[model samples]
Target: MFQPDIEIIAHTPNPEKVCTAAVKQTYKKMHAKELIKNTSEEEVEKLLTNIAKLGHFSTLEHACFTIAFKDVSVLFEQFLIEHRLASYSAKSRRYVDFSEAGFVIPDYFEDKPEMEEKYRKCMLYLFNSYKNLLELGIAKEDARFVLPYSFKSSIIATMNLRELIHFLYNSIYGHGKEFSEIRKVGGMLLNKMKKLCPTVLRYFDILEHKGNASILASTYESSKSEGVELLWHTPSPDKSIAIAALIKSTNLPTALLKDIKQEEMERIIQSVVRSRRPRELEQVNFTFRINNVTLAILTHITRHRIHSPLIPSLASIEKSSSYVIPKGIKENKEALKIYREAFDRCMEFYRYLKSKNVPKDILAYALQSGNFITIITTMNARELYHFFRLRTCLRAQKEVRNIANNMLYLVRNVAPLTFKNAGPSCYFYGYCTEGKMKCNRFKEVVEHYKAWHLSPTKIPGL
Candidate 1:
């Protein structure tokens, strides 16, 4: 009995006029303010039609929309966030007690009463288990591991007209059309767009399918390895960063970069890094293949928006038996037993659903937040430095901190000078930025990292 509640909270006023004015400013000598005031409604509509025909959509970015979604599954939330050109504020599972949070029952169950009853029982059991973990003094963050992917969550997403159109195209006609929930939401948003900016929709054809699912289908492959593996990195990363920096800082010609000595390159890298303007670091990149990452931690890593992470489809079945158990739950015998039993029950129900031949998309709702997945991600040196600074901190979640520390260790081996002083904010800045929430283990952290820097191969425990 789950229904998504979607509302357009706000949108750019006079959206067509805004887009039309933006288009006109490019060709006309008149300022945007004057052009908007002078442009007639009919003229705006005609101009937008012409612009759409010409395949110029950049002006569409001038119009923005803020939409709020409630009573939607976390699966849909994940799909929504995959549209990178948007802003999102989602309800936090860590802080929220989802014991009473409802879950989605896919349309596939409507025809089969017996299957629906079994599915309901499984969902209730998972929720009860989650609540029991809380009653046993487990933190909400740790207890959320037992929650299923179908659990209802809320999100407020904002996107410009161009991105919104792209999002709707995907949801309605692209790869997202395979999912019923996405199609429903896309239809609702399209209706709103029709009313708000009919002129824009008239020229924009939704039937022109933009998805490349067929072309990309053959490239899919299962992950064959585990843990963090540095799949690839830019060759001579330190030199790449140093060269980019020298090009910006010195008056020396680009031709002389080949003549520069290693000592001079190292000096330039040090100067650029210490200057605190690390844009040059973006010249180097690293790609990592991390396996067995929990859904909870996946959310944590994806929030760092500057990187590109390729995750499996939400409908895809997790083949690994691996799942995360927080230290708090593992240390308590009763909590550990409850946590393990919850996963076992969920998996048992999953197998039952699979035996019934339910589509993987519908069956995927049975997956626990603790379920593991493999992801491939690429990050530039600058973003990696930022990622390491925040995630390597003692304050960071243990699983993420471990991954961050490992990645830092790996990169330091190849690009030592670029990440020479990389680590937690305290270790990098010589002071904790968390104020009252600080870990107060400054000396321990500094000494550990200092040892780590000197012996790049050795990752000493803090």
Candidate 2:
């Protein structure tokens, strides 16, 4: 229920102040003792403008600011934390429980009482069901299976001057998509900064450029306008293509196999073995030693479809490309032969592994080279907790489970607040998404996590 604004108790990296001081030093260095020189503050502001045009960003980082933040959403909080240079504190879920917490109602939800009523009913149902479940011996862990992501929380963001400037650029008036609740707060904070350090905060003094400057020769150009700005993008992939090419190897004959090098025999052996698994899912249990080239191919192919691979590397591609339909005028059949042999060898091994009394889980792990494929998914505390609850289950893919586990290590250190209580169904979510397979011990899991990990705390005003 409490929505707060920026309360700057302190700050550093005052760019305007530093630029003014730096520019004035130019005079003091020259005059030394001669001139009773205090450069007019107007001169300082003008000098700061030119300095910004020169793109000296580091000078700005010297200025710092500490802000108090209150009442932000979990998603928005994560967005702030992702900006590493900033620090945060938020309200605790455990010590100060949300049992009677007042949550934020989205604009549209509040605008329509009927819609709000339905929404409140749903959320209340979830909370009450969870509470009742807890009272009825179903753990809070199990009860929380119904909670919605709209649950609101708050945080306090403490950042340096450079960061504060950056936040201002992204979230102020006259900015695009200023609807982000945090950005509005940022605008208010910037106003306060301008007041405390009038000469220093001159860079964000935009009226000079955006308004009066339009009475111009080249239209707001010659004088060079300025202020803070932030830019971000979904960066393009940069992994080397050569890696993909390298993975194209060993789907053929000339390549010497690590454990077996013979050509014709390995081919015959792998083919007969691989042919047995008719369905892609059945391939899940197949034992095949995928070479690096094969693994890379499988990586690209499976990511494209989430399907089981055929030959799983360059070899499969070559074999199929060669016989099924050939479009290229110059065909290198030898590469095709090597691929055939490698896959054959794998099929033979899979056949042997299947016949023996080996376990499905063990056989699944035995894959190397072509054996394992990894998916790159990134999430912070809240998201990671959700993923672990759903994906670390007995029903989740064995390989995905491994990935989820590995990611949890990074998640814990980076955003301790959100992830401290994150992990498998028993910990993050109650029971199972697959009802029949559920352990139904979510309450015990939540209590266990609560005992060990600190609940998130919302820091005031950023």
Candidate 3:
């Protein structure tokens, strides 16, 4: 059995004091040496309390916490690393021989003996196979392809107080509560943080809504999604709002936007967006819901830190009995049979463990890498352009490239003027960024996008 733990290995001494000093320096324009030496703890606390009360969190960035977690699974890594502003050092599956690593078991099946037996047998088989493959001279990276997400891994993560607070609030109060794993880890981190700086964390308690927790549980709990689906929300129904916002940087009067004709508005948007000035395209925000993507693909997409993603437990993937088979594998009969058999065996073990009442957390390791999961994420027009440029390239992973292509279609359908010039880097920049890795089919890619943009009712060819 694996026990997960989080230890605050290092943190700024007098964090509140440091933050308060920074606040005072910014507000009073005090000399750093003088401020650091003379600012009393009481004065710092008073200022920090006010800053929290006023919802000013940026000053907290001056203070950081470095935490180390042991016996946790890579399944939790996606959540921790999603905070792009933070720094991380985690145990890598590619380099580590996880033969000795323990596995996590969820509390739900603690009392179920039948389920426990099934789980033990399955895990034993998988681990034995992994060790055998090693003896057979298989690379750790390739052998690890069969390892489960439940395998215990360690990480030393560092985040500024601002991101820490955000992580805590979102975990305990918002969408984070939906996943039991995140809630457990969040509770542990919060307890540790409160001991370090009760004054700062107290702000969250003060801001809590009357029934926020109950509301989130009722709304988000028990939800599961499967297979590749792309959904968009809150698209600008009228392009004028985006056009006006884009021109707002020019300090133009509000009345001027109304006076501008549709054609002129179109011209302005196309010109600025096509110019590749992403800062200018930041005027509009786009939110997308992506479902049924593989866990591997989620890892790839989450690298775009500027975006926000909400993903369910990788554990829930078992219930879906779903997995993605790549095109090349599917095209060959023997290969497809072998791929399906592997997942089938994995699923059989997964269910055996469940029936025996094995801990649900440990069961996640039985999930195949190709298991499907969901992500509801958002990116502004600027980041969208960047995402499209990178992910839509031929050199990108096949799964994410498909996602990017769909995202392009969705955004273009709603805000054609804003995304008229958005696509792969080669198409957007008039040249491939991949250099020697270039697909050299830039012309064909451009023609495909052109045709897609011209159609009002046809699906784009991938």
Candidate 4:
């Protein structure tokens, strides 16, 4: 019987083991000989289970894994998206031509013939309705906007040792199979981790024990409190502070600016860029002009600061993005228009901004890296305001949370670096930061999150 939700495709060596190896290697400074060298797998596993004090973590990035997901519930899909550092490419709802559709039939429904028939009818009707919406010229996004999250989705996610540790810990220690029939799935993956990466996998086992202890303790407390159930929840809503949209447009195109230079097109554009006789700046007199440069100017400022490290190092630097897209060698009208508009505007803006008596601080923010044209964004590791204000909120977007998750993994890999014991407040404290604290899985959350940062295979502490 097919389950319509939640399945694991693949994971790397046990996360903790990778981490243990990484941490150990960073300090050891030797090529990673298998931590289980000269030892049997059973012996290695036992050692990992007992001797977890070797807190080194330097070579974790060397080991990574990619997991393929399919037939996931909205809850599970959302849960995975919270891990940002993992590379993902999901089937786009916008472009997928689902003229014909498919749906998974659960075991329970399959067992009940009548229910199965009803479910099948509903799926057909929903699919037809979606097709009809498209036929009516509704944008794919708007048409899909109403679709249920229960619909199937497939995503390929790439994870390094650090992230896998985080994902494994959370899934094994924190999550419950919402449908009650998928617990064995976790065991299957856990078994795999236990073999290939004993050191990291051992951490999962320890967390499992810790989780059980918590359950028992909670049960005892509940028993004393006359049969109260210990329920978990998300944190309270933040007060609506209307922070202005602080979007710093960088030297990036709104869309991925493709290099569409054909032999002739390249000759023309390059000629335009390096003209022997440059055109004089003649300001066209138009009072009604919006001076669209306000936002563009600000974005360039921030973008330049981010890419500065790719050229030179910043002490406050944590990490930078690799968002560059080299232009394509094709010709299209829109592409040509964009090339002309972007290059022209950028040149004009440069001259205009320079002519003005702009302040040094704002001017410093403008322009971009001389090379590497991707839309680079930088995060200052020491910037407490960024994390404290953003990561703790339940209302934060999922993509940002995933980014935060990646940041947490990277921080832990570098030990006592900017992100030590990193994560949402749950990792550092016994409770959620929100005043109401709706998600009661604080202990569970911390245990799950710690696996990524404290894997046995990676270096112990870097």
lDDT (C-alpha, whole model) for all candidates: 0.84, 0.40, 0.70, 0.39
Most lDDT-accurate candidate: 1
Runs of candidate 1 exceeding 4 Å displacement: 204-209, 214-224, 275-277
lDDT of 4 by residue, 46-160 (tens): 4445544343323455567666666653323434554666767666554685546354444554556764565455445545555665665544433442232234556677877
Better of 2 and 3 by lDDT: 3
lDDT (Cα, tens digit) per residue for candidate 1, span 1-462: 556888999999899899999988988999888999998988887888887777788999999999999988888888888788899998777778899998998887888999999999999999999999999999998999999988998999999999998888888877677778888888888888889889888755632446574454442334656668899999999888877888887757888886678888888887777676778888889999888778778888887888899977767655345678899999999999999999999889988987988886787698788888788899998899789889999988778888898899889988888888899988888888888978989899988898788888865346
Model 2 CA RMSD to the hidden true structure, in angstroms:
25.0
Highest TM-score model number:
1
What value of lDDT does candidate 2 attain over all alpha carbons?
Answer: 0.40
Model 1: how large is the Cα RMSD against the reference? Answer: 2.2
In candidate 4, position 18 carries an lDDT of 51
User: Residue-wise lDDT of candidate 2 within 68-177, one digit each (tens)?
Assistant: 65554443443354455666666643234344443444443344566456545544544454354344443322222223333456666676555666666545532212
Error of 4 at 363 (Å): 55
The alpha-carbon lDDT assigned to residue 54 of candidate 3 equals 84
